[model samples]
Target: MKTKIILFLTTVLLSINITDRGSASSNYFEADVIIYGGTSAAVTAAVKVARTGQSVIMVSPDIHLGGLSSGGLGFTDTGNKEVIGGLSREFYQRVYEYYQQDETWQWQDRSEYGNRGQGTTALDEEFGTMWIFEPHIAEQVFEDFINDEGITVLRDEWLDRKDGVVTEDGRIVSFETLSGKRFKGKMFIDATYEGDLMAAAGVSYHVGRESNDTYDEEWNGVQTGVYHHNHFFPPDGPHIDPYVSPGDPSSGIIGGVSVAPPGEKGSGDHRVQAYCFRMCLSDHPDNKVPFPKPDNYEPSQYILLLRLFESGWHERNNFFTKYDEIPNRKTDTNNHGPVSTDYMGMNYDYPEASYERREQIIQEHEDYQKGMMYFLANDPRVPREIQNEVKRWGLAKDEFTDNGNWPHQLYIREARRMIGDFVMTEHEVLGNREVPKSIGMGSYTLDSHNVQRYITPEGYVQNEGDIGVSPDQPYEIAYGSLIPKKDEIQNLLVPVAMSASHIAFGSIRMEPVFMVLGHSAAAAAVLAIREGQAVQDVNYNDLRNDLEADGQVLEYSD
Candidate 1:
């Protein structure tokens, strides 16, 4: 066992080349625009920069090209598809074109697939866009974009967050990666969900929820009793005890129940929302790999789930409610009920954690979610009906081929949001206040998953911070929200973790919107490069003209 462990460690060290000092042979790179993420936004931004006849380099931590969009979140959450435009819409159009050929349907016929999205057609012929797709197909589209533009992508290159950035009078000159390779650029865009580069560059940012008083919004802070969806304990069901021994105080709380007080209502805290992998599941016998038992699986950790089953969860049909269908008879399975995929209260430090620490957190989430599935499908304690239903699904064989058929990216719903020149609040998202300098539009309902699970005052298990609030209409996202304050950073733009209050971010953090902001951010970066100005100093008129000329939808009308 010791020999095997040492061999594995040595293999990993050599593969990463931790000892290499990054000699001049492959140490230095220069680009007109430097992107520091592998998200859908990063692809669009790179495409935009390349289309503008500028050199761009993508320094990505993950080997994958697209983030959640291609990471098992194939069922696109597009609210009002008409407002999605530019490279974002072009991406969907490419998906539409891919499915036009009969060869694209391998496991199921095209006619058998549902053409419905979030109240819209999944395959919108009129707009020439296809919303729902498979993980591999979305990734192929992003790769096609990169190949078409000749963008340089450095995959699996992590930024040295502690000492990577080299700033000169508020302008970033270069940033070093973990492998010691230095990349220099005239302008940079932090397109990561974690905002790693942005945070490393001394940019102002915020994590977790803010008090409702800070933003004067109804849905910005800790919410204890607000149940927007069916992700809560059923009110009519018998209360399940949170302790290991029912009606006993000394037995201690179960695995997921938080011991800390859930803060006063409407107050802020350091608790981040839950994180989970959006599992890509398949029911096809040839394409499915049965859920495997985790090495460190603990059945006692899921005792609450057993109690949930006893409290009528199966009769309520809650287990499989969020097993949303995608192409080829696959599923983009997300959190559904009181006890599901989400690893609540487990990712609060992820935003600012070290790379090694983040890896541990990711592995913990993977184990918990995968173990939950295994428990449900194989454990004798689970209801037979649920076990039978869960047994029908498994990991998709054709997806994430290199990563044990698991997703390459975790669904980081919210993370480090930059506190930039302009802060978007719910007032702007709900259309109560007019936003200036429109760069893009987001129409999705304000949504957030559960943050913490704890025993209620009545001694029953309950979840907190799940929110779903709809906006009156589609609203504009200001360009100022993407760039940092002029005094703080001169040439950096953050699109994925753009400036916004918590509730406002919930609406803007969608993949399509991230692509929209990425395209706009790249255009602004190019303008900044050409004009020899700070990102904040770029003229709004020129930025708007550039975006509109590229067919970006900046405004919506009824």
Candidate 2:
């Protein structure tokens, strides 16, 4: 009995931390392709490789797979669904399967739930697949793909950046994790949004927006006046005052406003776009967890929101959230209007920060967002109408329940973009240049969230780095954009953070497109391995043929 008790405890402890990379455990793994990051693309790439009868493993820092796809970004940002093929389309097709069942609509009646979508295609029902989904459902689909494909995924395994990478002769020999586990592969695919593995492998990359002159693109850099979206200038006349003391200039710029002058129109800067959780909120009373004031919540931090209200910009500026509804009465509530969920200028250090520092930033964002919810719902200063409306909604109890019903992943819109051999510019996204060696297609408008808040020259507050430019059609992404230069890294392929300018990346950074590129990247990797060639040396003709065989829409024949 004594020995059995000890055995049970040992088993329990081992099971509890089997996947924890923080522990001092050791192992070695080898695969045909080593894909880092458990993003939507990561899983799809693994699925593609597995489908092609190759061994692949995804080593991700995230315990939860499907970076933003399952990370409360259920309302997918697919532009042209027609162009989304291969493994990318298969994932959405599964979402439709999950929702078509009567048992899937737990909180809401199917007949009562109205269909919704935006321009061109109706996301609710597009013949074969459904676009809008609950967070839990999206996650389940990704998990199901893993189970069915028998893909190996090591969760919570962070890359060892300092000395973890082992490179030889411009090729990655192996990469170690924080947990001391080493992964070696014939070819590597960096599917992370942060581009950690890509950067660690000595790949040339860019951290911030490039000068328009660098890429000869018009919308690449500083534009203080562009207001393509319904932010900054509210429907009401004069913009919100940016001073802490309202009209007093000596009071210093308000907490959220940047003092730096908007740089030259086409000059480069180290500013990144704002990020916020696509909170899975719900109005369903049975599944709603009322917003709890965070441990570090401070009402004073939201003084800018109060100022907006006092300035008569409340109703017109989405005082609460842009609660885009999904299936089962849940919402993919994102930052809407100025002074919403996005905490601008606070996350400029996130992309390259230490893990601890990034954690701090993530916590700060959570607290600020939670504070906003609590303030709007209970603050006496809030208008009764706005307060009442906010009170009706809360975090979805069924989603991310283990994490206090909060989103497990922050929406990292853009991070380290690789500067590969052939950089994707506005010319390719806008269909100006004849793109060659097509891998996938991107059709979304060049949309970027706000990067900084600064006092305008006219003494009113304005936001910069929010520009929206539409593309002509589903543009083909070049294969050259996915590979590092032969001299830097010969065996690496980057799909998520592939070569692209900031403005051009805005159009190509959709989740579906990532999955498409994931499929292409894996296809290229498998071919490269079979032919005994470097990733950069893979024959584009053979790669394109394989991608097309797998139903990837490389080119749109209009």
Candidate 3:
């Protein structure tokens, strides 16, 4: 009887913790705020929580810290720099400070690199910020932020999406990970690009483009004929056939080109935009690792590209157009042209796929991209001049040191967007409607990459769903978009995957804007905890005040 009592007491103590604040054991962790993600927004949100003298735990699936910001996307897509304030601007300022040191520029001298950017200079001396930098530097800055705040971060901890969340009366009490580790907190923030937690919590969300009629907007759904960027096969330039053997229908459709008919202009579909790695490449001989052929390289995949070159598209000499140069003689190479790095139609299932399935999809993308590079650089079918230029560039030896010096995070351009109290549409983005309860501002063009590459009725291959509509001005993002319907979840905030129409999210999904929303979401979470109110019930005026106090730009004047 004595032994039984001692054993029972020990088991009880290990299972439960009783304290005003939270506690941490081998299987359980408790904190005032729990953030799930490793994106730029996740880092900013964690910093905000820790700055308010609260206990915060970051449950991240990424082994590295920053998602796209530090994952080889050094060339920032800052549409308007004025609207990017708070921690987003602070991140750029740190980049500037790091570059100011003489030793920071290694392969290339500071004066040797051109200071170019999207709409502003890369190195802004007056603003004390730098928009362009190396991948490792951005990762270091994120690490420094975590270290400065003394925040607790658990890396590579994936959420158990099957049955991990414990909710009572619309509040999330705790969520367990795949390793049986559970996290309990007063407030939660879903800063992931995929919105995994938001979906697992049974919150309503949308996976694909909503019909324009669904949101009463003009650009929400399928856009087959409208080609805003130079990412399409020019009708007059090249009539590249989609068939494997030129014009033979029995030869079957070539790889990367779909056979389905392009859907109606205004109709909705279950398709998603393409995804690719924002590769960091170096031209410097000492720091460049030549592109290697993937073990499962498929030469047949390049047949379409070879046909495009054969049909005279190679005369443009635009293969390196998107190789935007950053510091240290490296480049943040992104997708360009009709058939580039953007793996079209390959990621439609990634948003809702299981962990093992998502891994397979990711591997497919990696193999395709690696093989494409090797084909371009070494394959005899490639134009000689193009192959020579491709051979000059290779993966940066200093970036993404692990995983064979390749970026660990894929550019998940768009994913599961939460359907919450408010949904931002094109009317709000184009300044036709006023947004209520501003939490942040976004100024990027309504941009969506090519969603599919299909055979046109004319038997030629063409890309569809690429859009780039500029906003009338910097627009406010509503606070209501961050929270689920008041009845669904009371203590959770989703800033990265906030409620927005497909067109609206195209503009609102910039990295700087995400950090702004993240800071605002954390502010709201902190306020709700202090007032003992639901996240949806937090006063907008108080949230605005808190955001402004934290240097977040919630409104635009010019």
TM-score of each: 0.95, 0.94, 0.96
Measured with C-alpha atoms, the lDDT of residue 232 in candidate 1 is 84
Candidate 1 CA-lDDT value: 0.91
Candidate 1 lDDT, 1-558, residue by residue in tens: 999998788655533442242333467777789999999999999999999988888999988888999998878889888789899999999999999989999999999998767668788888888998899999999999987876778889999999989999999999999998998889999999999999999999999999999989999899988989888886556777899888887999888998788889999998888999999999999999999899999989899899989988778675787888888999999998888999999999999898899999999999999999999999998989899999999999999999999998999999899999999999999999999999999999998889998877777888899999999889999999999999999999999999999989999999999999999999999999999999988999999999999999999988
Model 3 over residues 1-558: C-alpha lDDT tens digits?
A: 999998788556534432224554567788889999999999999999989988788999998998999998999999899989999899999999999999999998889989998789999999999999999999999999998986778889999998999888999999999998899999999999999999999999998899888988888788878889988999665588888788899999899998888788878888888999999999999999999889999999988888888877768757789999999999999999888899999999999999999999889999999999999999998989999999999999988988788999999999999999999999899889999999999999998999999887778889988999998789999999999998999999999999998889989998889889888899999999999999988988998888898888888986
Give, for candidate 1, the lowest lDDT window spanning 10 residues: 15-24
- Judged by lDDT relative to the true structure, which candidate is superior, 1 or 2? 1
| RMSD to truth, every model | 5.7, 4.0, 5.2
Residue 392 miss distance in model 1 (angstroms)? 1.0
Q: Where does candidate 1 stray beyond 4 Å?
A: 1-25
Which lDDT value does model 1 have at 394?
Answer: 97
Candidate 2 global CA lDDT score: 0.85
